[model samples]
Target: MWLYITIGLVALLIGIAIGFFIARKYMENYLKNNPPINEQMLKVMMTQMGQKPSQKKINQMMQQINKLQKK
Candidate 1:
């Protein structure tokens, strides 16, 4: 019946919402523990580009990256 179909749809939606939240939380935690890029990687990239990355520059870049991720 139509009532059964409605209940099934509702259940499916609830499952999807729960899954989304769970996945989002997991990714946030993973990113916090292991950032996408680290200071070493940044230095490597800068060196590759023929630029010596200073500590201040690295910290600035890290702050910017963190801000972006938070947004």
Candidate 2:
């Protein structure tokens, strides 16, 4: 009974480690190809809060904001 319990614990730990490894790799690749949504959201919130941004940054920010708002 004790041996069975030890084997079960080891298997559980190995499974958890494998799951975390796969998830981390997937997320790393996913983020590399994807634009960060939070940054765009923050820019939109800042604009809504009425901050005076420069012309170029404002245009870029507005574009992202519009794109997100459309979705």
Candidate 3:
């Protein structure tokens, strides 16, 4: 009885560890090919969060980003 309980607990722990390992690997691979956030996307997200960005400010930031990309 006691041995069975111990074995069951060990199996449960091993299953949990395997699940976590596979999830981490999957997420890492998924993110590696994805691009990070851009200015427009950031502004949109901020707006959704209740903060809006002005058009002039967004343009200025985009111009700076373009200049950086040209370098």
Candidate 4:
């Protein structure tokens, strides 16, 4: 019984460690493929939309985006 219990605990710990590593790797790849938006990207987008992107407007949009994400 003691041997079984020790083996079970070790297996559980190993599984948890493997899961953590897999999840970390997945997130790294995901971020690499789809990086977070930045001011430069936003400026390009606004320009494409035919709007002149001013610094103040960019800051305001960034703040609004942050607020939405926080919710």
RMSD (Cα, Å) for all candidates, in order, is 1.4, 7.7, 7.7, 5.4
lDDT agreement of model 3 with the native: 0.78
Q: lDDT per residue, candidate 4, 33-68, as tens digits?
A: 764877899999999999999999999988887677
Candidate 4 lands at a TM-score of 0.56
Model 3 poorest 10 in a row by lDDT: 28-37
Stretch of 10 with least lDDT, candidate 4: 28-37
TM-score of 2: 0.54
**lDDT by residue for model 2 (13-57), tens:** 999999999999998778657656555566676788898545677
**Regarding TM-score, does 3 or 4 come out ahead?**
4
The segments of candidate 4 whose C-alpha lies over 4 angstroms from its true place after superposition are: 38-41, 44-71
Quote each prediction's TM-score: 0.84, 0.54, 0.51, 0.56
Error of 4 at 55 (Å): 10
Residue 70 shift from truth in candidate 1, angstroms: 2.8
Kindly list the per-residue Cα lDDT of model 3 for residues 2-68, writing each as its tens digit: 9999999999999999999999989867655553547768699769978778878777877786567
Considering lDDT, which of the candidate structures 1 and 4 is the better prediction for this target? 1
Instruction: Compose the digit string of candidate 1's lDDT tens values, residues 1-71.
Output: 99999999999999999999999999999999999899999999999999989999999999999999889
- Model 1: which residue pairs collide? none
